[model samples]
Target: MSVDEIIEYLRTLPKGTVVRVLVMDKASGHLWSSIVENVVDGDVWCREDVGTLIEDKDKKPTPENIDRVLAAVPGGLSAFGDWLTQEGWDILRDIYDDAIDALR
Candidate 1:
């Protein structure tokens, strides 16, 4: 799929809404969890540890001061799908996964 297709896919989910998603590695059958932060432009931001979404300083997942995604690799949307293209991974929605799947 093209980057736009992936971007379009990201656009389907509403911003600020907690969701359970999965990125499956086709080679090892390994699964990784992620939080899709901004849908417009930016690395596919995600707080790997959902518990830390609202850091000690913040008590809410407001995206401004709460969502603390790292500044390094996993930070942009294009980089996301582009990396996705490189990794041969697939993204799926699992509504009943776990609390950590949520953005909040």
Candidate 2:
């Protein structure tokens, strides 16, 4: 999806839901990583870092990184449900779905 769509989806989240994007860095002959974080912040917060993927000067996670975390995070479906219940965060489930598709 487009950035605006992603941002909009993020905006609709209830509150205080820990949302993050992760990316890989192929620097120093090894692969490192960083995270682009966006908590509810009463709405949404977005910061896309460049050079994080190709270098480390200004690091930020990539969409692929987010996909990896999502794959590893146990109870992926329940995580959102839990967010809704525990943090009262409104999750835009479709956003995640679209994210996965975009990465694929």
Candidate 3:
């Protein structure tokens, strides 16, 4: 799905969903509860509470931080999707499936 569609779907979720959210800077990470707001240009817009851990360092979220956050979430779904866009579905799927199975 397009980022806009994905964001729209996220916006429709119920409150308190245990979404694996992360906010970070070049050097640190924080986790939070999140929902999607909208997409602007080519980037996905996420609506999330600033995670206390991530915010304690006084850092603002950045694209690189978003990438790092996505990469570390479980099911590896978001990372897999993003990687599939750049590296092809087959490769990331193989990697993701393997990671998922290993976790079980």
- The top-ranked prediction according to TM-score is 2
lDDT of 3 by residue, 30-81 (tens): 3333434342223323423323334566766555555666567676766655
Give the TM-score ranking, best first. 2, 1, 3
* lDDT (Cα) of model 3: 0.53
TM-score (C-alpha, index-matched) for candidate 3: 0.23
Best by lDDT: 3
User: After best superposition, candidate 3 residue 60: deviation in angstroms?
Assistant: 3.0
Q: Across residues 1-104, which tens digit of lDDT does each residue of candidate 1 receive?
A: 76579778878977766554557555643455444545332233344343265555466644444234433437555675587656542332343355447647
Instruction: Put the candidates in lDDT order, highest first.
Output: 3, 2, 1
Against the unseen true structure, what C-alpha lDDT does each candidate score?
A: 0.50, 0.51, 0.53
Give the lowest summed-lDDT range of ten residues in model 2.
42-51
Kindly report which residue pairs in candidate 3 clash with one another.
none
Clashes of 1: 6
Better of 1 and 3 by TM-score: 1
State each candidate's clash count. 6, 4, 0
